[model samples]
Target: MSYIDGFVIAVPNANREQFIRHARTFDPIFVEFGAIRVVECWGDNVPDGKLTDFRRAVQAKENESVVFSWVEWPDKATRDAGMDKVMKDPRMNAAGDLPFDGKRMIFGGFAPVVSLPD
Candidate 1:
């Protein structure tokens, strides 16, 4: 089974283009480091919930939008090693200034319990 790294972020709406450019520049590094795929999704219909919601999870402001993204890896070992290399890779420093607030981002690694059409 594949390993997954999921992320949710709040990005200022005005920075949408900057965010895409940033992703395009850096997302490929994950592939070079062994990630099978990287997907970034800009929120389209995310709604507020009475108790909890994606918006509140990252404390998204009125001027911001939620971004849901993930990375697919062959397995945990590969993901761990690749992530280490990614951090040490020099190209990471080339992506100047994050388009979103890193402090408000939420991320985690997940093991799939169920997948469709297997």
Candidate 2:
């Protein structure tokens, strides 16, 4: 089974293009580092919740949109090795500022329980 790294980020709506550019720039590196694929999804119909929800989890503001993303790797070992190399790469070191509020971003590694092929 593959290992997964998931992320939820709150990005200022105005910075959407910039954020996409940043992701586009880094996505290939994931594959280069042994990831099977990197998926970036912008919030389209994210709804608000009184108790809990994606928006609430990240404390999304009116001017911001939530981004759901993930990277798929063969396994945790490969992901760890790839991540190590990725962090050491010059691109990461020089990537400069993030277009989003990273402090509010949520992320975690997951073991997939079910996946139906499309």
On lDDT, the candidate that comes out on top is 1
lDDT for model 1, please. Answer: 0.97
lDDT of 2 at 94: 80
Identify the leading candidate in terms of TM-score.
Answer: 1
* TM-score of each candidate structure, all chains considered together: 0.97, 0.95
- Candidate 2 has a TM-score of 0.95
After aligning candidate 2 to the native by TM-score, how far in Å is the CA of 58 from where it should be?
A: 0.9
- Worst lDDT run of 10 residues, candidate 1, spans 109-118
Put down candidate 2 lDDT per residue, 25-82, tens digits, no spaces. 9889999999999999999999988889999999999999999999999999999999
Residue pairs in collision within model 2: none
Q: Return the lDDT, model 2, position 47.
A: 94
Q: Enumerate clash totals for all models, in the order shown.
A: 0, 0
**Positional deviation of residue 71's Cα in model 1 after best superposition, in angstroms:** 0.2
